[model samples]
Target: MAQDSGAPEPDDKLHDECGVFGVWAPGRDVARMTYFALRALQHRGQESAGIAVGDGKTVLVRKDLGLVTQVFSDADLAAMPGHVACGHCRYGTAGAKGWEAAQPHLSTINNVIIALAHNGTLVNFDDLRRELIDMAIPFRSNTDSEVAAKLIGYFTQRGHRLRTGIAHTMRMIEGGYAMVLVRENALYAFRDPHGIRPLVLGRLGDGGWVVASETCALDISGATFVREIEPGEIIRISDDGLRSERGCRPLTPANCIFEHVYFSRPDSVKDGSSFYLMRHRMGARLAQEAPVEADLVISVPDSGTPAAEGFAQESGIPFGTGLIKNRYVARTFIQPTPELRQMGVRLKLNALPDVVRGKRLVMVDDSVVRGTTSLQIVRMLKEAGATEVHVRSASPMVTWPCFYGIDTANQDQLIAANMDLEQIRSRLEADSVAFLSTEGLFACVPPNGYCTACFTGAYPVQIPRSFYEEKFLPGYEPNNLAPASKTSQMTLVQAEELLGQEG
Candidate 1:
C-alpha cells in the first residue's frame, strides 16, 4: 500500500513480527539485556513488544501492544528485572492482535511451569486445539503459541520431564517451528523435525547463552554465532554448556523458501547459505528462466533490488529505476480496505517519469499474493508513460497459505493458486507477465533445504483434515501435481531432473 511519507497512514491486516531473543545466566540483569535485544530486533516487528524473564526459580513477564520503544519505559524494563529472559516483538499474523494473545505464554502442568516463546507455527494446531477442548482443557488466549504451551503441559501429565515433555510436544507438532522454552533453571532450544524453521545458538563471552531465530539478533546482542540448531535436533542449554539431543523421530528438512526471499535480514546466514546471496541468485534464476526484451529493468523496491541485479546480469538487460519509493513510509500495508490499500500503494511508490517515459520496462517483484499492490504499481508505471510493462516474479507464484509461521497468503486469496498466467496478466493489466518455474526456484536455494509447498502444494508434513473455516477430507487423494499423464508424481528423482533442467 502507498501512503504519503509525511502522513502517518495506518494499515491493518498485513504484519511481520521482528524476531525473538532469549538469554540464560545464573544471575544478572537479563531483563535489561532483553530490552536491548528487542531494540535490535525492532525491524522484524512493530505492533507489540514483550519481555518474560526467569530468575532461576521465578518467571516474571510484561508485554503489551505497541512498538518496542513505546512499550518499554525504563521503569517498565527495570521493574521486571531477572537473570534469565526471553523477549518478543510480535506482528500479529495468526492470533488475535490483542495483548491477551501476545508471546511469552506461561503455562503449568503437573505442578511444573514453563514460559515459552516461539518463532513459527504448528501445522496440527486445529486438531490439537480440538483434542484439548474435548478433554476439557481450558484456554485463555487464541494463539498457536499458547496451544504449544498447553501441549507441553498436557504431555507433562504423562510423566515427561522438561526435555521429555518438549520431545513429546515435538512429536505432536508439524510444520515449521523453532521455539525457546524456559523451565526452572534451564533454557531449551528445539527445531521442527522438518527444519522448516530456523534456530541459531550463540554464546556470550561472559558465560551466558542465548538462542534466537536468526544470527543477526545474536550479533546485535554481541553473542558469537555458535551454529544453526539442526533440523530435528534439540539443544538444552544451561551454565554447564550444551547437551544436544535429537527429535524422537526425524523428518527431511524443508526450510521455508520465503525466509531467503523476503523475511530474513540480508545479513543473516540460515543453515549454511547466505540470505543475500540466495536472493541474488533467485533474481538471476528468474531472468534465466523468463527472459524478455525490455528497454530497462526496475525492481519493486529494496526487496527486489538484489534479484533485479541478478536478472540484469543474466538477461543482459540494463536495469534502472522506473519507480521511486518513499523511504520514510511506515507500515501502510495495514490499511483495512481496498480503497485505502490502493491509496497507500500509490503514496509509497510514484513513477519516475524521466526514466520510464516512453520506455518498455520489465518489473521484478519478490512475490504477489493479493495482486492489489501489483495492479496499483502497474497502473503507476503506465501513467508514467511506460509504453510496455513486463512483470517477472523472482519467486514462484505463491499457491498456498504457509502452514508454517509466515502466514503469507491463504489458499483462495492467492491469485496464482486460482488463476492461470494469462488471467493474472490480464487482471494486473500488464503488457506481459511471467513467473519463475518451481524448478527455477529449486535451483535458487543453495541446497541448504526448502519447503516449496507454497508453489508445489507438496507439504513437508501432513496437514490437518480440516481448518476452522474449511473442511478437508483425509480420504480424498491429493491433487497429484505431477507434470503429465506420464507421471504419478514429482518424486525426488523427477525433482532432481527438473532442478538440473532449470540450472
Candidate 2:
C-alpha cells in the first residue's frame, strides 16, 4: 500500500503475501546476509521477520511478529550461529493480522528438524489439510507452509534425501509457491513447476550461496546474481557443492503476470524477462487491443508508465506526461479519513493544463481492481481537458480473488468478477473504454507461461472451492469464522488433521 515513488494513491490497494531469504555457507555470515536480504524484501511483506540457523543436527530459531529490525536484535542473530540458515519476512497470504502466524516454522517430528519459509500461496491447501487431518496430523498455523513442511516430512520419512524429498514435494499440490528449507547440514530450495512466483540464486565471493524471493534481496545481501531457479527445477547447496535437479511434474509454465505489473521489484529479472520491460510490452498490447485517437498516452504514473509508452508506440500517439505525480506522498496510503482515497487521487496526480486544454486524451493503467478509481480518474480527465477521454486497461478484468497469498480474497469487492465489460464501461461513463483482450494479454507475455487464474477461472491447482470465497481469519477456528453468505457452495468439511506445514 506504500507508494515508494510518492505517486497518488489509487482507490484500490494492491496485495502480496511476503518474501523469503535463505543462505548456505561454510564459516560465512548467514545472519548478516539474511538481515540485508530481508531488508531488500521488506516491500514484499512488512509484518513479521524470522530466522532459523542450523549447525548440522541442532537448529536455533528466532521469530516474532514485527518488522525485521523490531523482531530481531543483533543478539538474536548472534545466538543463531550456524553454517546454513533460512529466514522469512511475512505479509500474509490471507492472514490480515494474527501475528502469531509469523513463519520460519519448525516442527520437530522424529530426529529431523525441518524449518521452512514460504513466499507464495498453495491452492491445494484446504484439500491437503483435510487429507492430512483425516490421517491425524495436527496443524499449527493457517499458512500453506505448514502443508509444505508436512509434504517435505512425508518424503523425508520415506528415506528420501534432501534433493529427492524436495523433488517429490512438488508432486502433491498446486498453485504459486517458492520455498527455502533447512535441515541438519544442507539447504534446499525449490519453485512450483508453473513458476507462478519467483525465486533466485546468488553466490557470495566466499563460495556461500543464497536463495531469495527477489533479486533485490541478493543486491541487499551483496550476493552475485546467479540464474533463476527454473519452473520445476530444484537446486541443492551443501558441502559437496551446488547441484540442480528436475522437480515438479512438468506442466505448462504459468508465471504470474501480475508479478511484472506490480508484485516484483522493477530491477529484478524473472523468467528471463525484465519486469519493467514486460510492463512496457503489456501497455503496447493494451493499446493495440483498445486503441483510441488521442493527443497523448498518459499513464497512471509509476506502475502505469511502461505500459503507457508501449500503448503510445503502438497507437502512433505521442506519449506525453498527461499527469504529474507528487513524489512526497507516504509509501503507504492507509487514508485516515473516508474520502482519503479521493484526496489521494487529487494529491497524487495533476492534469497538465497546457497539454490537455482541449485535447482528446488516452489514459493507461495496470488493472482496475474496483471501479472507484477508474470512475474517479475518468471524471478528473474530463474536468481537466478536452473533448473526449478514453480509458485503456493493460490487463484483462480481474474476476477472481487470489487465495494464494494475494489479500483480495473478499469476492464482493471485485467488480469485474461479477460485472460484464460493458457494465464496467458504462459504470465508468467514459467516451470509450476497452480492456486488453484475453488473447492480446497472453501474447504480451510468453505463450502459456503465467498464472492468469485471477483473470481466467481455470485454477491450475486443486484448492477447496470454498476457500476462495471463505471468510478466513488467521488462527481462528471455523465456528468463529463467518462465511461471505453469497458464494456458491461446494463440498463440506469433515473434521480433519494435518501432516506438517513444510514448504
TM-score of every candidate relative to the true structure: 0.85, 0.78
1-503 in candidate 1: lDDT tens per residue? 76545533332122344478888865667777788878777766777778887766777788887777777888887787566788887766645678777778888876666788877776557666766777789988777888888877765555346666576667665656878887666778888876777778899888888988778888877889988888878788776778898854555667877777777777887657777787788889888888888889999987778888889888899989877888766443244465554475776788899999998898998777667778878898998899998988887787666666765535666677667899999999998898877788778777666777767667776655454235222222333222121211233235334334534
Q: Write the per-residue lDDT of candidate 2 for residues 295-404, one digit (tens) a residue.
A: 87788877778888889988899988878888654334243454554454776677777877688888888877877777777777778865777888887877666665
lDDT to native, each model: 0.73, 0.72
Worst 10 residues of 2 by lDDT: 487-496
Whole-model lDDT, candidate 1? Answer: 0.73
